[model samples]
Target: MATATLISTISTNLRQPTATFQPKTPLLFRRRQVVAFESKPWESQEKVLRENAFVCAASRRNSNSSSSITVTDVSVSELDDKLRKVLQFVLWAAEGVYIIWLFLLPYAPGDPVWAISSDTINSLIGLSLNFFFLLPLANSVGIHLLDAPVLHPMSEGLFNFVIGWTFMFAPLLFTDRKRDRYKGSLDVLWGFQMFLTNTFLIPYMAIRLNKPDTKYTPRKDSQLGSVMVNGASVVGVIGGAACLISILWGLFGRSDSDFGSVADRWEFVVSYLGSERLAYAFIWDICLYIVFQPWLIGENLENVEKGKVNIVKYLRFVPVFGLVAYLLCLDVDEEV
Candidate 1:
């Protein structure tokens, strides 16, 4: 009975629940699991910082290079501007000196050479044509033909014409449109003066050198203007043709006692003026015409509509300067 009670007591002791404590999972571990489940993809902080630094360095290098180039270009441009101004000033001074010399030549001691030179220049200038031609006429009349009256008008006319033409035409050569009323009026005034004098052309050319290229617009012609242009052209052609025929007749056909042939008239002209003076005058006429004619054609062409293969423009290069022919054949745009 004791053994049985002892076994029962041991069994009861084993079967009875023991008072034992079990530890719970850590709070930090649970939080980490939740974060891992919810987290998005992200770059490493160190890698991001390195990439930003590289970009900043590249930008700095590019900025430094660009700034250096800009500084160099500015300095070069300033130098060129200064050089151009100096060149222009020198040219202007030279031209002024020449003009003054030409004015003073008449008062200078009259050597035979100088007198002959002056007479020759006067003959080609057209100012003294009446004077020279009138000399023979004056011989027929009672008056004696003198060099003073002839030379004075010739020199004065040439100088005045140069100045007037230059100033009047400069603005026209450079600008396509005149938006300013004051400037437009000034241009008109200059143009009017050119018709009278033609000497202001020198200053006009100087002014043009400093001007920028302007955008050109073609001008439309009106009915009356077109009619006038055509009429003028036709008249010019007829007059030119007559003039040419007259010259050819004088050169070849004329058998007058005085001024019989082209050669005879040329000899008379040379004898009347002087070889040195005539030569200089001829040279100046040729040079001035050569220099101015191209610009004149260009100015006229600017207002005309362009098309493929303009034969008339090409014909400008023909001998005898082709100026008369050009004027006769091609109608200039009259809108401007």
Candidate 2:
């Protein structure tokens, strides 16, 4: 009777609807791929656990690993540290480029360019370009701010131009990695480059985008001299305000209906042998080079080495004098 009942039950299960499928547990239905794990009975599982522990420890050393690792071997989170280092590097690159292009290059007298441009584009281009900048590239060709020759001796204007943009471009390589900040900066750069390429759009965009409480506020809480930087901004603001006041005092509130008056006053103050601005800019460049540049570069170099990504040690081989030449005309003078 028992055998007959068991057979009947088996037949019933087999005859059940063909479409019905049984649910599978992981261990029951998993496809078994053949992998050779050779070890003494009872030892293979132990070996795997030991190997896994070693792997967990080794992964902790990765620079990109999280700072927040745990015994369960969660990867270390370096989000903050890596980002800070990257931001510093971006700033260094921007500042270094600025010093070379704006400050040093411009220091050379403008007579060469002035003579070159004198006829066609010079007279008008200088007035247009020298709106705020002191370097009257146009004036060198033949333009006057107010019956006075409007030229910044080349170097003074170049320095300001480069330094100003250095701050603007610094954040590009910086990965606050904060998506919102990153997106905001990308927008600003796009806008800036657009304006640079087309000067006529400036007034239109200014009106369209510049609502004091609404559109004009800086996109992100930034690090450069913004209130975002604690001590630095405070110091910079006070000094910057003072300089701005002095500049306006010399520049505006005039009835002469002059065109390049603002540009002329700036050149008078920053030109070499004219004001201390050249020396001052050079000094700041040196401070940045010696104190900040090396450390930032070093951090990146180390990261490359540790990552096993090959790098030329050309930076190490570079002479310290290269940096020194930045603040003073060391290279130019020494060669001369």
Candidate 3:
């Protein structure tokens, strides 16, 4: 009996300890599972935060791109507008200076319009007759259509040289895409230009800068315009050849007369330009023509034949010949 009681007490003690520890172990395990569940939610929350950040960054990039494009477009438009205004101002200013320097200034070389001399008048008549040798060549060949005036070869050559260049501009002016912008009669303007030269042309240059009229109808090409446009190649060759000949003629013409050597003729020309108003004015016209020729041709490169556009585009930077070449390569079939 003593042995059985002792064994039972030992077993009771061991069972009591196991029951107490098992309940506490299960409670600790449950607390650890709660911590694991909480950590899983934190991982999902972190993933959501990263996704939102990516979306916000992408939206910002698109917004910045659109804003930059808008800014670039606005800037280009503003720059173009400013440039046009500046060009208009410069053209008008040139006109003012041209009138003042050539006509109004008494101190300028040669006679003012109000006080032109008879010798100057005689020189003008001779130079005009010498142009294309319309009268002089006829007289020389014994046709005797009109009596040609006699003047220094230098004066004759210079006058015709300028006129030749002026003639080529007819095709350019008529074919200008913006020609309809001018409201005046082109016939009258060009007629005046043939005699008056830049006195009329400068104003036309400035006036052509007027903003396009949306409601205005473009006019049909005039009869003169048609002639010039159709015969552009012939005009180019004739004008270009005339210009080349004029230079040579200035240096060597009137060989039978007492004009002296080329060096001496060159010296006389230098003095004439400094002392004669017409000669001085011609210098101004030539300078202005240099600028205007490239300006006009470069703007109208589209009028050139397709295969010849690159040729004319580069040649526009050249002086008188550049314009001549442009005329020779004009696309006659294209509408002005």
Candidate 4:
């Protein structure tokens, strides 16, 4: 009976549905288990971490390169500044030495003509009278003097003419109009006096040095006509004409027979070099032409207009003809 009952129970179990024997877990949980078995979150995290490390390394390299470049640039800038300062000091020292040599040249050994010639003295007196009295007296009556000759002894005329024109040309090289003062009238006057004496230029230079920071409206800020009509042009024209006339007369005209014949002028120049006054004068003139003029030209270059080429700045380094070239190429309208 027991065996028969057992067989009947098995038959009853086999006849029941298979679903009745399933687990208690939900269908959604089983689907998630299958997905978790296929995908790996930890492996994906490891891959992302590796990519991040690589990016950080590249960024570090770029930063290091930029830092190195910055350091190199700073070093180069510092070196350039030092070199510029050294050059400026050398120039100043050279100018000082030249001035000292001029002062001492008069005291050098050997007999030198220190006293002014009687002929020069007489010429000066005549010049003073003509400028102070005759010219003014003639102008009051609407009668203009064609020319007033001040320099005596054709050699003196040549000296004054050369020096005066140099002075007139100098202010044009100044970058700052205010530093030049009075529309460069003072510079013109000082330059004009350079023909008579270099002593005047010393004071002018002293004043300029002491007030190097003086400020004024830049030429670029004002109307072009303002600068053009400020009398500088008129003065320049007159002074240029006078200088040309004096140069011609000194080279060829026979005004003073006392200085010897025109052919002997070269000999007179040689002898004049031996004189203390003329030696000092000549030295000062050289200093102005070589040292000061070039310096001023460099300053003027700082104010050049954008996109404009200033060839005169480089040309100013050439002797004699350089200044002439600069004047010819000067564009007043383009100056700062």
Show where candidate 4 strays beyond 4 Å: 1-66, 104-154, 173-243, 255-259, 298-321, 324-329
For model 3, the stretches where C-alpha displacement exceeds 4 angstroms are: 1-71
Residue 242's lDDT within candidate 4 is 52
Give the per-residue lDDT of model 2 (tens digit) for 254-303.
32435346666566545542333333444444344343333323333322
* Candidate 2: residue 134 Cα off by (Å): 8.4
Candidate 2: pairs in clash = 65-76, 66-76, 66-77, 66-78, 67-76, 67-77, 102-158, 106-155, 107-155, 126-138
Better of 1 and 3 by lDDT: 3
Q: What is the number of backbone collisions in each predicted candidate, taken in the order shown?
A: 18, 10, 2, 0
lDDT of 1 by residue, 1-336 (tens): 999999998877555423121246564444333333433345544454454565556666678677877888899988988876776686477457434543345532222333546544554454434322344345445676543333322233333233322332332332323222123234444455433322343444444446353554433533533443455445344434433443453344224334355566556544543433333333343355455545555545544435511544665454232444444544354344
lDDT of 3 at 54: 59
| Window of ten residues with lowest summed lDDT in model 4 | 220-229
Residue runs of model 1 more than 4 Å from their true location after superposition: 1-94, 106-198, 212-257, 272-283, 296-301, 308-313, 317-336
Residue pair clashes in candidate 3: 109-277, 110-277
Residue 226, model 1: lDDT of: 46
Off by over 4 Å in 2: 1-75, 78-135, 143-158, 164-179, 182-282, 285-336
Q: Flag the better candidate by TM-score, 1 or 2.
A: 1
lDDT of 1 at 164: 26
Cα error, residue 261 of model 3, in Å, equals 1.0
Give the per-residue lDDT digits (tens) of candidate 3, residues 1-336.
Answer: 999999999878765444434555775445434343443577776775564565566666678577867887899988987887888888889888888888878889988888889988878777876876577667768987678776778887888888899989999999887778898878888888888789888888877877888988888788998999999999999999988878988898778789999998999999999988889988988999999999889889999999999999888888898999899999999988
lDDT against true structure, model 4: 0.51
